[model samples]
Target chain A: MQIYLPIAEMSVSVLLILGMGMAVGFVSGLFGIGGGFLMTPLLIFLGIPPAVAVATQSAQIVASSTTSALAAWRRRALDVKLAGVLLIGGLMGTALGVWFFAAARRAGQLELVIVISYVTLFSVIGGLMLKESIKEFWSTRKGAVRPPRRGGQHPAYMRLPLRVRFYRSKIYVSALPVLGLSLSIGFAGAVLGIGGGFILVPALLYLFRVPTAVVVGTSQFQILWTTLAALVLHAVANQAVDAVLALLLIIGGVFGAQFGARAGRNLRADLFRLLLALLILAVGVRFAVELVVRPTEPFSLVVSEMRE
Target chain B: MRFGLALLLCLLAAGPAGAETLVASLSTSQVRITSNYTGSQIVVFGAIERDAQTVARAGPYQVVVTVRGPRQAVTVREKSRTGPVWINGPQQKFVQIPAYLGVFASAPIADIATPGQRGRLRIGLQASVNAPDITMDRGTEDDRFREALARLKIKELLFIEDERGTTFLTPSLFRTPVPLPVTAPPGDYEVDVTLFADGVLLARAGTSFEVIKTGFEQRLAEFSTEWAALYGLGTAAVALLFGWLATVIFRRD
Candidate 1:
């Protein structure tokens, strides 16, 4: 069953990587999140180097996002104009992120920074989602308001230049907020080597008060570009991409994304958040353990003289 | 005068009376080393031969090659193999060592050496081995020894295995015997080959090679050119800020 991959230079069957991609892609589609957060760690566990896994995962995200975004767009759920504005910010943020990433590498603290950021962000976000889901579950049992909507006036601080009205979401928000959110997600995407759809989906749903229907589509739209940009940058700068591994994951992810998008329609907002939170916490803890624990023996490889 | 004549006659009788002529040759005298972002493996080949019958018994020799330059020294060794193999019909028979094809060892390089400089190294050849088996038919003991041999790493095992029995070492005919990087620092190095028979050193030989550096700065310039995109993006961020600021300042009420 072993096949030697030309790019990876390792004996790994395509089927095995595809199966892993399908599982991760399913979750990504269902939750409107990029599965890079989970897939990268899993690849590393399977002995792929961290840099290769991240680069390959970025390529896989393109497949997953395109498949899911198509479905959400067909449902009349995408806000194209808004997503465009966000992309402008995302592109700028990604540039800054790469510079920061290179600086961190030179400082020899890249791993520590990535580990700490993942744990802190996931812990806070996951805890909030779990609490909200529990409250929503109890309220539903008591036959409380079905899909409760906020009634208070929107915050004034959110106002800025380039005000745009989104008719479907029934809101007029400044482009500045959208741009700022995109930049933040873009920075996260670049540093963590993820698609940043997880953060974008939640921000659109809650902070921008975009309808849940439009959030998935718009987030995917922005994520697609961001992931592509990151992939190109990583490839050019670090030569980190492994095309063989990326193709293996994409084949399964494309199909899984479709099913996930379909299931996403039925899931409640609080429940989806809850699942995301739990996944983030689990991955965070695993990363923490790796940083804390040291291996028994340290081995070094000796490089012989190179032949002309 | 009689004592002096006796001494001269004794010296003449003992010197070069029954010396065995052995020659060591490689396939190639020069090897080029290139920069590798990832690790690479290189092969070295050579052989040794003795004059017919003059070499009554030869074996268990060590070949050592040292890479010299930049305060770092790398050495490679080939150890002799001795064990039992299961033959036809479940019978265990000890195989004789092959004589034509000698030892082959591969070394993996994880990092590229600083290249573009000519360096010299020495290759030394010597004979060394453990005591031979005492029993005529050590069946179970030979099995145990084989098992132990299997557990040893590549560095521990010296002989190359094939369908035939073990043979005496032979010179490798490959074009490049050593893997040298283009960025290798300039220095002198040596290669040593030794022949041993039953733990006794019989003959030794050595050779040398040099590493030279060339066109290093030009390569660095190309690297900087490719990396300019990162710098371009950083400076453009300020332009983006200014555009945003202009939009805010020139907004229509």
Candidate 2:
């Protein structure tokens, strides 16, 4: 059935929107990430206005990440203290990001900025994940069980003031890097309409050497809060969130996440990492291609602020 | 579109003294956009009135009806290759242009009136979009931008022209359906009807209709802007509730 979206000022097929949410949610569940990066582009490809697409998907991310975060909490995989620290900066960054988003829209550069950031972010994070996962996959195939290493010397950059021991991740690092990392990622996430979990998971894994299992849970917890903040900010600042669209997507997402989580449990660890890494790279390449390629219709439209 | 309202006939104009005058009205004064509103069509119905001393001297009369939605500010941007990426290039900002425009005619527009005459009356699609204040840099490049804007609007069905859209039921009565596309902005829509005979402008009549959201849709739009903080929280709450419910039903841990 076709339903009108009030904020978007468009009519879209309910089934089509539901299907998009289901597919994106399945990825979110399987990877334990919010999958906002995937869903935002898909929404725009389906012809929802970019402002509405970005704002509405922020709300959808809250729904998907909440499921992943709760599941991780139940499994005792999530670190609540770490999430609390991350959120302190994440919320601050999200507020700044929303203001930047409004400024970019007024300048008619929002889409260009979004595409460029997507290509740059995914290429870096996806490349890193692919390299690490490939190394682990081949080592395991050679029947070499990974050996436990002695506690390593702290990375030089991490030795800063205000040290804290994150009991869950079993790491002692300066809180500055943690706050800075999340704050930067939060700003990037809010602008790009993503949960930033794809970047967060690998950053935790590589920089702080967070345990892989804990990384997914902790990142999901962080995504849940940041995206909730983004949703609220976009709604209040831009007034562009489509309530109808968000509701439809959430309904489908809840069902898809259940099936994906079940499927994820059966996958081998090394193989799961390899698959997710490749998927992230593919989406990054898609955005890169869109940038350089000559568009079929080069003209676009925008409604400026109301003229009194 | 309905006609035969002889009692409501008011003389709008006459080509000469005491000649035939045009009288017109619309099917509805307001179009309510409900949840299921895909699009709508408004019928413009009219009649020809003549006094006791008047005479029908010329060929068959022609009717041209134009419906223009509320004036809106818009910017049209064109993308061009810049380095390895394509970015918005030259842009044109229109301070006031019809968000929705549709034109209906009893005959082919070209046959009804000459291009110059049509342009003067601002009767056709080309004339409707042309406003001197809209284009500041009047060059071929700016022309391309304006044409591109029209093309884009036409592609979206926001600009429409249907020759033979209006039909005459009798010698004095006529009606036409002016389609308002799904994307039509909600506001006042001006409907102008013109009469032509032998390529000469004869009579003119103007009416208007309003496009408005129904109570439910109106409230939703207003609440999003007025109570934005609450609206934002409510959407988030719904998401959180759904998330919690999913875990209850599907949790494996």
Candidate 3:
């Protein structure tokens, strides 16, 4: 079916939108990224209003994460207690982010912020990925196995009140750290219109050294709340959420998430990281091009009230 | 047979006084006026040929015009029922529906006076609806107008038809003759004309028009000004807050 979007005045075929959703879902599942980094840009390219695109993406994230989280729980890999602590922090961060968004709107400086942030973040992430991929290629030529970090005592000073053990992750951490992580992910999730799965997964794996099996599950757990909070904030604060568009994307994402989770189980860790690096690089480069090339007319659908 | 001859004799009697052709046309042939409105309006106008028939009836005519468009089209037909209706404000809210004011005719169209020798009536059009005790401010009025235009589904052009004649016009071509009164309620409205023959239903023509508080250019400017600062501060605040929380939660253990 084809539907005409009112704001964009474009005919969007359901099949095309579904295909895009499925493709993003597959990548998200394979690499454990929330897919917002790709989805938002793609929607903008397709002429969806930026605000609507972000809000709708949040709605899709809720569905995608819900499906993925359920599967991870079935595998006995989710650390629910840890996720709870993070969620607490995430909730606070989302509130703060929304406040900041409103302030920026009033100040009339949202676009500059968006452009600068995109360029800086993408360039850094993309450079890192290019470096990692080159290193991997060199390591293959050397034909030497990368040594794993030797087990060592847990660091002090990182300790917080309410220490708890995660049976699934086989680790003990203070609720403070979990709460802090959740807050950070929550803030980022709200601002970027992502579920925070991509960031959370990396934080868990590298910073916390959580086992690979638990990483995806914990990330999904965190993302579920992050996406949900973002969705609610966008709907209430900006009135940007389009329920119909969100429903369509969610329908495609649900099925895709199931397939993605199944495929995720068999993927190699290094290969997954490489794919994530490449995807981030692609997104970063795209944003970079947009920032540098000055268009004759500003590329945007939003009409400002100041012009009148 | 006697009646038929009498009608023919009447026609012959009226045919010779330098007959003028009065051609009437509407901007759109079909319109969808939502029932959520008290009443709606449209515009109907056309050129009169120099040699067409002309009538000397002044403004007042009990005109009944039936407008048919898509069934899903919401016309300005509102009932006095108590229910929740969405109201546009700083924050959109659902309020108990009030008695919606129906359509109002601004001026009993003065007269279909012939233009020079031509039987053309090039007259300005205006209509309004009132909602007493209902605040019809600029914002609300624009919102209602936008909603009506959206319902009109006029992508490129609209066709108008009536007993006088039928005409097609693009939305961009129609011009507003007067400024919209600030007190007007938020509702659908159009410029329209009603035709009457011996005080009976003849034809009606109209076209959808909108009154916007802010033009397109102004909106673009405001968006650009606000977008830059907000996006940056919002992004950083988010990144830092989330980063700190992540550090606190996932410390090395």
Which structure among the candidates has the greatest DockQ? 2
Q: Of the candidates numbered 1 and 3, which has the greater DockQ value?
A: 1
CAPRI grade of model 1 = incorrect
For candidate 1 chain A, the 10 contiguous residues with the lowest summed lDDT are A297-306
lDDT of 1: 0.53
Best-performing candidate as measured by lDDT? 2
lDDT of 1 by residue, B115-135 (tens): 110011111101111113211
Chain A only: TM-score of every candidate? 0.88, 0.88, 0.84
> What TM-score, over all chains together, does every model reach?
0.60, 0.90, 0.57
State the C-alpha lDDT per candidate. 0.53, 0.82, 0.50
Name the 10 consecutive residues with the lowest summed lDDT in model 1 chain B.
Answer: B117-126
Runs in model 3 lying further than 4 Å from the true structure: A4-11, A129-137, A153-163, A236-239, A299-308, B1-47, B51-206, B209-253
For all candidates, state DockQ relative to the true structure. 0.04, 0.58, 0.03
